[model samples]
Target: MANIPLEDIQNDVDTIVSEWIDLGLLKRGELFVIGCSTSEVAGERIGTSGNKQIAKELFTSFRKLEEKTGVSLAFQCCEHLNRALVVSEDVLERFRLTEVSAIPVPGAGGSMAAYAFQQMQDAVLVESIQAHAGMDIGDTFIGMHLKPVVVPIRLRQKNIGAAHVTFARTRPKLIGGERAVYSKDQAKSMLCD
Candidate 1:
């Protein structure tokens, strides 16, 4: 933590999310899976300590990402539910996603996800998903939350605190074999190109 002030964290988040958008890592209405480890932000093991302050900082940045990209967020829970995500009502309707019933707590949902749930206007827990893009903070394990094809994204900043971060966006799973010629442009378009 370097005993760094919380402001630095907030600023870092804003910078990262914006950079993610600018780098064509995400787009409007696409699902943005976030698997945050608040403990790591507080200089602890992945799930050892869920700090509200860190969650709030991350949430502020996430909201900015939401506003700028119009990307729907899915807060990935911990190993519980195999890291099933919670999405907004708009996301549920857009993707016809099923809304399970579960409210995130600091311990159960991890602080970052719980904070997102608190800030979101309309939120619902979903048992499964195929998200368009995702950021796994502290390696909360968001692979289960992504779509059929996941493309890794390398961010300018590798780790966002003590947590190791990973980002990826999905592509339409290529089904056809030798005869199939997938659109290269379509793949690039997935990242908001």
Candidate 2:
């Protein structure tokens, strides 16, 4: 396997995250889910070669993102943990999320999650969450954890290291039928009886 410099991983994360932030989708106090596969990021098959070093780099970048945006971070574990999330205790309590029991290791939870579980203060595993926005690294399938009405966000930095990255932000589902007005202008034109 080719060695991937840790700095490369950090740079990719920084660039991708910066692009996402510029999109104006993430908000303060919102939950942001991250699903990553370190093996894939290192140009290997997912789950084949998990690397803690890579996870460390990613965690560092994510921490900066959280500090800058005020968005809470949630790391999704691999299928071995049923894709449960590692989140700060504050977020679990603030959001009233269901707590789960598990200690993530590199082999089971995937590197990114394990690193997050270790580094985050008062980190706890949660059964699930409805994140306001999320980024999927290496096709970890974080859709289930995102809120309803997910909208795909396209970013210039497509891949983080060797991993293909996808981003999304949620919106409230638009209800009502065709007669319902959506925008302020449309509502203004309508006269109530």
Where does candidate 1 stray beyond 4 Å? 175-179, 184-193
Best model per TM-score: 2
Model 1 scores worst on lDDT over the 10 consecutive residues at 1-10
lDDT of 2 at 175: 91
What would the per-residue lDDT of candidate 2 be over residues 84-188, giving only the tens digit for each residue?
A: 999989999999999999999988898889989988879999999999999999999999999999999988889888999999999999999987777877677
Model 1 residue-pair collision total: 0
What tens-digit string does per-residue lDDT give for candidate 1 at 1-193?
A: 3365787677667768878879875777788889888888667877777888888888878888889898888888887555667788878888987777778888787787677788778887888788888888887778887887889987787677666778898887788898565887866677584
lDDT (CA) per prediction: 0.79, 0.91
RMSD of 1: 4.9
lDDT, residue 187, candidate 2:
76
